[model samples]
Target: MESRKLQIRDLTLRDGQQSLFATRLKQEEIDKLLPYYENAGFYIMEVWGGAVPDSVMRYLDESPWNRLRTISKAMKGKSLLSALSRGRNLFGYVPYPDSVLEGFYKEAIANGLNVMRIFDALNDIDNVKESIRLINQLGGIADGAVCYTVDPKEEHTDTTVKKGFFGRLFGKKDEIVEPKKIFTDEYFVEKAKQMEDLGAKIITLKDMAGLVNPSRAASIISKLKSTLKVPVDFHTHCTPGYGLASSLMAIIHGVDILDTNIWWFGGGSAAPALELIYVFANKLGIEVEVNMEAVGRIRKELRTVREELHAFDLVKNFPKEFDPLTDTLPAEIDALFDKAIEAAKADNEAELLDACHAIEDYFGFPKPNLLVKEAEVPGGMYSNMVAQLKALQAEDLLDDAMRLIPKVRRDAGLVPLVTPTSQIVGSQAVSVALDRKKGNPDYSNPSNQFISLVKGEYGHTPVAVDPEFRAKITGSPEEKAYDVSKYKKPENPVLPEYGGVKLAANDEEYLLLELLPSVANGFLKRRRAEEWEAANAAKKAEEAAANAAAEAEKADDEPITGEVVTAQILPGTVIEVNVKPGDKVNKGDVLLVYEAMKMENNVEAGHDATVKRVFVKPGDIFAPEAVLVEFE
Candidate 1:
């Protein structure tokens, strides 16, 4: 044992809520726990960043800036306040201009943000270089994260390559083969040193998927501690049951800080529980002085708050009627699963096991996801793919999509799957699977984001993308380098009164508006209207009723057209419309692009047709299954 003090960086407010409840934990719900967390003796409390900035405004109608300020005030300088930033991307999926980065960091530090854990999805030093510089210049600790991913020991070869009779006889059959090891321990060590060179105050090994095993964690942490002058922090999740063990190894190897959460919300897909780690560290003769009593109080209160947010809870959403031991196995229940015989007849073992896990999760049993471990994917990535497929109404294509993800990842130069990139790759994989199922050629109908990724727009992938594939995706034989300086500035929709709604009374509000325009716009408008209505009660009441009637009438008149094309999954803002009324289109041509789930989804034409009427334009928000275009 190293016998050094192991500091705990608490992630309950940000990643804990994000991992467990879809980041829908309200600011008021968080306000109740701040006092306890203040006394909890945590080294750092992560309260902002990740999906929090967007989720709070989009779902809870709360300002992310206000939440940060409130928590900082409540903490009273007891614990360091931290937020996660996605390098040049900030909180959004796409990279913004330098002005956006500068402004966002300035406001974040001014709001009492002590630390900014900055990372690039692809681990590109170029992408994060400016973010590290900006945060340090703003007097906030920039904890640079080397996003973690690993190559599989082997990969199953594609069966399509072994086609004809002679080819079948002479060609290598589809079989498992060793993958060239690219992300070795040395690769991580070099990346950490590069961040240190760039003036990162600390280096963090961010295993977003819990893919790092105990031994691997030990090797990397030890190497980082030895090679780097800055302190090393370990951040991992318990999605695949590796968080506790790997985090313990990190502590044993003299990791300066480790991330954890409350016991209840700590383990599945989140970090290890602070209480458990405190006890284990002490048992191993390491000093980790966390306030157990405060932790207990926070846990007690959070459990109650969790019940109030049951609608967003994954565990709570499982069917309550299933009882495998007593109730008949063939009983029909929720559509999430089928009766026993039908399920067995269809050979839907994956769905059956998922139902069992859901039941176990509902009953408060230990629900570990072995699929993530077996597949060697981070739990979040796996779940994101499944959700994407479900939303596309291609649930049956889940296996095809899942199998295609690794290849898609490899084809894109083996970029580490983290937020934005994980989402990008997963979305692309689903799109590819859907296209292939529809009899399109391989690599046909690639998303614009996917094309950008291959063309090196998101910075250099781990391994360079093959030149031929790059040409196919980019429509040019020669690869073109992307320059951030030349990138277009994001639209500033923070007018005093835009779309007949008040927005941006202050710089903080303006920052929110600029960072996430659509989400912030919707929330800010409602917030301003509520404030106005509170002051002018009688007049607003009458207007509210009239508006309600108008909304109801609009709801009844859903968009109708001959061969209407609809958004089949979720509501999103139309980011781009590539076609106009009366424009001719071919099968697989991207009609319009929408922003949803932090991804720019390209809606493609299903068949050759002419555009009769384009129902939406850029900046228009559409609902699930809303008709987007009409064809004749």
Candidate 2:
């Protein structure tokens, strides 16, 4: 009997880029890669949204809208394009009101988004219900996710909780830790069924951490196929190095689609190698169709992309000797699987988990990571924590932070390691460890974001938060679930300008900017200015680059005619201004005070400088990039 054909989905432009390059693969890089992806036989290409948009604005200093539109036009329906919908949160952590959600979805669809792969961090079906319904209402495919995790048995949960480097600092490690609710096959199947009922055209088994075993994956897929009427897709990472196995088992049990990336950026924390999987499936007599020529060309081209961005790409840490021509899984990988399974079957979960940890350690991982299966911290959270600590120059505290994560998460109600929840728990874990190191008394108090999460402001968690634990963080165990529609509506979308030159000329552009005004506006301003520089250059491109370089070096002390360092507040009300134009100030001195969310924030100078300009006066309400002070 013939096997059912498998549909391949490429995530190279989205998750793959984010995984390998920290999503620094610029729009131009994607543009160069797009023609190749267009012919790559992907069921759909994930080209926009997810971390890409956030990274574009924050790190790349580019317009995410431009990225999506450019790729969308290039693909020209050769394949459907999808994006990650963080449900109520969109790209940010806040659970924005439905009106804001509408703006995000509507604008994305209008700009050529075809699929809404929506998933809530907690697997809260309630949080995704509106998005699922809205995706169909707006003529987009709804792909709902059943995020994968292995809920350790009650007896085994204790083994998962470990201490960071500051293990001895946690003297308050509660002795009577309560058992977390065990997630069962039923839970996964039920979630899939709910997605099916909510108009999801596809159900995605999202194994972000690659913690799902072949046996468990088969069970979930079998149960989901029997229960749901929609096609089932699977998404996983190669970080744990077991993705190929889990994917094969999933396909055998009836997953209709699998997410992958080109070989060049395919492994590590990224997706399964699309080339490897295609060859493997075809060799196994599994029905699949692929164009080796197109894939090879793309792979060759990606090698160039990798080299061009070699400093940023982490794929070098992955297997170096992979040959895509012969669809083969390396014997080393097979050997690792043997060791991992043997560990899983050992006398205790600790032995099994240790073996798994040993395998991860065997692989030289350069990026952020906490791969202990017992802890089940998602890859994104682990990487994000590492990045955060590195930025703070305290990366030595990573091990301490890693060990602290499980404890902090459990204390905060064992919230699932997914989006806002992952970020919330992760940030708090860092805080706890940092406080412990500093002997700060408020080490246990979670930040406002974590407190809001405990209040049920984000949405329902898998299990009710522990009352005693809740009281420790927020002074009460009361969970704060709210009707998102009733939450304060986001302020009106506003336009950005420079010297009265309005940047967003249309409502669509304005709405896109509204998602992240300050970052997006600054990015657009810089990007457009660079383009203008390039186009109007009377000298060679190298000279223009050199001129920009020269200006950057003398930027702070010798700037005039609007080309000065500026600080602006977003969604803020300026209540105080500390200086006017031409005033001298010292480094770290506050230039002004603005209030956002009732919290006063100060704009400070990074270096001692004379004020070149003051863009705002006291009592002015301004959006992002409304300069507070320009430095000489």
The lDDT for every candidate, in the order shown, is 0.79, 0.72
- Report the Cα lDDT for residue 190, model 1: 93
| lDDT score of residue 328 within candidate 2 | 53
Q: In candidate 1, what are the lDDT values of residues 1-632, reduced to their tens digit? A: 45578778899899988988899898888989988988989989999999999998887878788899999999999999999988988987777788889999999999989999999998999889999999999899999999999884344545334446776677666633355689999999999999999999989999999888777887899899999999899999878766766776677678999999876567777887775566446555778857777877887788788788788776563223322223432233333233322332343444434543443354353567788887777777788888878787889988787778788898888988887778788888888898889999777878888888998878888998889888888876555556657766435444444334447666787788777888887787777777666757867888897996786577447555569799968899999999987999999999999999888899999999998777777998999998888897
Location of the lowest summed lDDT over 10 successive residues in candidate 1 = 317-326
Taking all chains together, each candidate's TM-score versus the true structure is 0.73, 0.71
TM-score of 1: 0.73
User: How large is the C-alpha RMSD of every model relative to the true structure?
Assistant: 22.8, 19.2
> Model 1: runs farther than 4 Å from truth?
1-3, 156-177, 316-365, 481-502, 534-632
- The candidate 2 region of ten consecutive residues with least summed lDDT is 490-499
User: Residue 413 in model 2: shift from native, Å?
Assistant: 2.7
Candidate of highest TM-score: 1
Q: What lDDT tens digits, residue by residue, belong to model 2 across residues 279-396?
A: 4465556665556667777777787787877788765555443445654545875465455444433423444444434433444333224354445677767778888888888888
C-alpha positional error of residue 133 in candidate 2 after TM-score superposition, expressed in Å? 1.2
